[model samples]
Target: MWRDPGAPADSFYEVRPECTDVPKSRFRIKAGKTLSARKWHAAFSPEGYLDIGKTLSRIHRGGIHPSIRGEVWEFLLGCYDPKSTFEEREEIRQQRRLKYAALKEECRHLFPLVGSGKFITAPVITEDGIPILDPLVLLETNTDNGVVVPPQDNNAGSTMAPSSTGANLEKVTDKRTIQWMLTLHQIGLDVNRTDRTLVFYEKKENLSKLWDILAVYARIDTDVGYGQGGSLTE
Candidate 1:
């Protein structure tokens, strides 16, 4: 006769690692006195190399101080190299900001719906090849009750015309550009659904920021494409 641990003797059983070595401290900073900037600098090496594991252990034990958590997160997230000095990190930050700005400018140039100051709007091509105004835009601009009034010049207008510089924006429907736009659109949809209960997510500007970051990532990592589920959840 076979021995049974608890359930019926014939029942099947499987075992898996419990991950006992992993830290179990709540992943949250403490309430009152948060980690200080000075303490943060001391946690890393003079060479700018951060002992992330050790630092995380400390955070797990004591929790981060609320005040310095934001700045500390930048270091934790690898936004700045742990081995870099304050001055070096600042320089890196400025360079990254400029790079991200340039990417946003490029995105705006390619997609008119982007950077249009209307966060909820998207480009919709009608049967006549003319773009229709987004319903959200209509909601804001139209005083009428849920009635959408089409623009006067439904036919191809100056907005749809080729640029004065002779750049045939409409004709340039390259494969890569189309893919990027599709990825961006999917990212926008994901952002809207992400953390919907959070007050910050309620603002369109915050959602726009999420979309921009995801779009830039998609542009850089063409192989990965746009991911759903857990990719946007965090």
Candidate 2:
């Protein structure tokens, strides 16, 4: 696996940066508390302006400053909701994993990436004065892993693993486990939210793909039938 600084590391918290001299009245720290239009503009000289594409080009070529990478990601995701504080953002984050198992199974193609510690997003700051960023940090972490932990809600004492019939690597269709599958699926979608809706794919199209994957898995691995609206409900 590629060594990346962004891989999972020891869990600890650090204090975020303080607001500079930007006018507190007009420019407020928003969700993620890492970015604001006023704050961003302030990062440059008062006379300078930023073009998003050009700025990204610079960062991509020159690399993002280590201190500001989190802010840059937040800005790119438009995750800085003005109404949500860091604590609120965290609560929302916790609620995102109510359906993890289903999501992992839904996007099962990416499973190998997770098990290989390839999806990690933390930097492994080097001992050298100049540090490099790496994304492979753990065998189990990914972009969604930060906000969503494994499902904790107990439902009827059933374990999460698919049944033997459904365990086939090529397919998963255990009917008795539809409830568990659907629950995990919902959690997956919730944790992947962005301020820009459907940023990566068309909303309807993505949902359709999810439906096809889950429906097929269910039919082949379980006795479950796809009742009307069942796919959407998932």
Candidate 3:
């Protein structure tokens, strides 16, 4: 069911110090019970069938525990079917992760800001898809004293030859890659404001993850590409 745009959210997930002054009642789940991680895992049998009917009923009534929100969302978002076996689900997740890694590599090649543990807020690519090489342009990095450790590009290496990582990017003339570059700035812009005050996004890596995820999405979903509200939805 769609929530009315004018109606209040069922619950507030983020709680900054500024938000602590609000009454707790305002944040309570509708049914007084959120689905716990233990119960969620328990719903899957040893053979790996998820009791989706019960799960949906619980979520409809109370939402999910914050601790398992992302995990539960994988199901709600159709990452896997309720009847999928554990082995099948694991296979799907592994394949999806490999695909994500490969896509990130492609984005990294187009704009090194990706996988550099830093995020961009200013426009980096022009309308013509030419990238600005300002080394100091990155806003912030998720690092230990700013030591960035890029995500491994070898996750998909076993399935395919390693991607050409340090090729002369100046010769990049692929239409799809160029189109993807054109949207990087907007993705970065939206990422900068998305969850900026939330504790989860306090770490810059999460911000980078958000940018790369959307960048890759924009690259693949050419019809819809990137939009202003994509980050908010993410």
Top-lDDT candidate index:
3
Residue 222 displacement (Å), model 1: 0.9
For model 3, the superposed segments whose C-alpha errors exceed 4 Å read 1-27, 30-33, 130-175
Question: Each candidate's lDDT (Cα)?
Answer: 0.53, 0.36, 0.64
Arrange candidates by lDDT, descending: 3, 1, 2
State model 1's lDDT.
0.53
34-91: candidate 2 lDDT, tens digit per residue: 2334444445433333345544555554444434556666546765443345566666
Task: In candidate 1, list every pair of residues with a backbone clash.
Answer: 34-65, 34-66, 35-65, 48-82, 48-83, 49-83
lDDT of 1 by residue, 1-234 (tens): 853222221111121244234333343343322354566667777656677776777676565664566777887777877667767987888999998888777765455444443333343334343334565533432222222232334333322221222122232234565566545545666777775644556677777777767766676678986797523544
C-alpha lDDT (0 to 100) for residue 224 of candidate 3: 90
Instruction: After superposing candidate 2 on the true structure, give the runs of residues whose Cα lies further than 4 Å from its correct spot.
Output: 1-64, 105-234
lDDT of 3 by residue, 1-234 (tens): 964323234344565666555444333433335677877998998989999999998887677776688889988999889999999999999999998899888766445556666666655444554434455432332223331222245332111111223222232345666666667777888888885556777777888888888987897789999988699887
C-alpha positional error of residue 115 in candidate 3 after TM-score superposition, expressed in Å = 1.1
Total backbone clashes of candidate 2, pairs 3 or more residues apart or in separate chains: 19
**What's the TM-score of every candidate structure?**
0.58, 0.23, 0.70
